[model samples]
Target: MARLKTLGSRIKESAGSRVKVVSPGSWRSGMTSSQRGYGYKWQQARERYLRDNPLCVYCERNGRTTAARIVDHIVAHRGDMALFWDETNWQSLCKPCHDSVKQAEEAAGLGG
Candidate 1:
């Protein structure tokens, strides 16, 4: 118990020690992925984006609303933080359109 308490104190002391320190990697001493809300933040972002772009992107282009239920990436926003915040790369698409785009891209060897 004493040792655990000491470790906790050390971590608390080092809270902001490294700006580059990122979770899903660190938290070595003793912490869980869920202890921090790393996954939740992204979920929130997705919900917000879906609410904002609540129409099938392709359907909208054709002057209709298929009630897009998929949030797609015009250019997939992999782990790139720069594009993470860019709404331009994200579009709402119906499942069919999204799957079609993904499939076509994969066939063309342009999938990411």
Candidate 2:
């Protein structure tokens, strides 16, 4: 009887001999909240806001009921610490609504 190789083992064997080509000025990078200098304070604030507003504000407004997974600022902070920390300016949103609709609206408002 033959045993099946695990996916990780197969990937490891194939990756060992591959030569990856990365461009010197490639645009394949992104920053996380912590990488952008948002530390434990930001995380705690987010959690608290989400806890208070467990449902997606956008979805609720549109007559849908969805659980929120992100705490979003009503106005873009644009490096303004005061606005960023304003609890009244926060709203809860699901990942899809935040990523698709809210982001698009923000981008459009920026004339992009």
Candidate 3:
């Protein structure tokens, strides 16, 4: 007979594995987004940036006027607080462009 697997056993398997699994937009440190610097200050900055740059840059390039909903780093910050907070390195992007095109560029090493 096959043995039944409980939730605890499944979690134990993940804990015992050498490779770690992380969800999108989450750090490997397992800290909350606020702890990782997406706290109140970052939220305020993001709101101000989006207000100043209300259209997606990529969409604007294509003659589309999509509303910007995300502020992305032109270069990957990689835990560098200076780069992370640099207003000059920020660009406004629609959710679709940020999630798809920007993510692809970062994955392909073109974002930096």
Candidate 4:
């Protein structure tokens, strides 16, 4: 008699069969403003801003209370060093608010 395979084992076996391969070359990836030169100082500023303002500024403005995990610049710095380090230009925002709403607004030329 043939042995039967369990559902979990069959699923695992099928999943393990597929493999993805990529060719290594000079495929450079773009870096975000924060990753380029904002580095250590930006991290420190973000931490301090979050500590002082734990709630999402955008959500608060919209009458909702959400914890902020990102320190965003009110104005997109666009490689402007002075604007990048301007504390007054910063605001605390949640991941969703920053990535979705804020990004969309900035893309549409609605945000500074």
User: Which candidate achieves the best lDDT against the true structure?
Assistant: 3
Assess the local accuracy of residue 6 in candidate 3 as a C-alpha lDDT between 0 and 100: 61
Lowest-scoring 10 consecutive residues by lDDT in candidate 2?
A: 20-29
Q: Compared to the true structure, candidate 1 yields what TM-score?
A: 0.54
Q: How close to the true structure is residue 101 of candidate 2, measured as C-alpha lDDT? A: 89
**What TM-score would you give candidate 3 relative to the actual structure?**
0.75
lDDT of each: 0.67, 0.78, 0.88, 0.81
In the range 40-81, model 3's lDDT, one tens digit per residue, is: 999999999999999999999999999999999999887788
Clashes of each: 0, 0, 0, 0
The runs of at least 3 residues in candidate 3 whose Cα sits more than 4 Å from the true structure, single-residue gaps closed, are 1-27
| Order of quality (lDDT) | 3, 4, 2, 1
Candidate 4, superposed: residue stretches over 4 Å from native: 1-35
Model 4 TM-score, all chains together: 0.67
* RMSD in angstroms between candidate 3 and the native structure over all alpha carbons: 6.5
* TM-score of every candidate relative to the true structure: 0.54, 0.66, 0.75, 0.67
CA lDDT, candidate 3, residue 50: 95
